[model samples]
Target: MRQTCVLLLFIVLTSCEYFNIKKTSPEAILKEELQTFNWNDVDEYPSFSECDSLTVKADKKVCFQQVLTTHISGFLQNEIIVVTKDISDTLVLNFQVSETGQLKLIDAKINALTKEEIPNIESLLYESLDSIPKIFPAIKRGQQVKTAFELPIIIKVN
Candidate 1:
């Protein structure tokens, strides 16, 4: 009957396994994934304290700080760079992480803060970010959410 055909059509349309498809990342696929993910998670990464937040979004909890314990030690041979030019010691590096947890540098800039006109401000911030060997991303539902991180590295010349 007509009712039977209409029912079959509705079931067929709803049962398509399209939305359940597992997406892969690549030049073209990567663009599509990023475009979709961008719309899904509108909430910012969870912060310990919030000034303007109405309710704490604790769902974005992080297990521990990213620790970089090896490799980037004095073995890397990092030394102080002299001021042959008007280079600011305060460097801000914006880094992005891929799905496989590889770091990709997006941008880096020299000291923006003028308080660095003080003594050894650059050395202190740089060492802290560099100290962590392995970077930890904010974890949500046991999945690593794509986010940018800032690493400040300063080497004391004196």
Candidate 2:
């Protein structure tokens, strides 16, 4: 009876380890869950209001980009700035689309020749983004997802 009880106890202990209920941290769990979707690729890109009616995916993509470019260009045109010296560089805009379809500007950087040339460039970029309408969030596997976008705008002062 003693031997039988010991065997039973061993079995119980081994079984518990076999069916180990691993306690995973919330961050670890989220990372594992997100692994199912490719972070670099989205099933559908975020769209602007003007792109809603486009049936073709390619057309929708182009339309969205065009509209975004137009809005940014218009905003830059409205901001009156005088360049004392000729400067040419690219301005990189980094932004994110929240899962709930909200546009958030992350960062804006200007490759300025001098600090005095565009001291308020970052704030100007933020104001320009603020003027934009709420963007539709990117879709991943038929579900809305938080996604990042990088837009490079060529700046030239002749």
Q: Estimate each model's TM-score.
A: 0.34, 0.70
Write candidate 2's Cα lDDT for 93-136 as tens digits. Answer: 78788998787778777664734687777777777787787688
Model 2 RMSD to the real structure?
7.0
Clashes per prediction? 9, 0
lDDT of each: 0.46, 0.79
Pairs that clash in candidate 1: 67-133, 67-134, 68-132, 68-133, 68-134, 90-111, 126-152, 126-153, 126-154
- The digit string of per-residue lDDT tens for model 1 on 1-158 reads 99999999998999897668875657888787667664444254422232123345444323111122122225223544343335335445566654444455566565544334434543533453444344434444466667666655443333
- TM for candidate 2 is 0.70
Poorly placed runs, candidate 1 (over 4 Å): 1-88, 111-138
Q: Which of the numbered candidates is closest to the native, going by highest TM-score?
A: 2
Give residue 46's error in model 2 in angstroms: 0.5
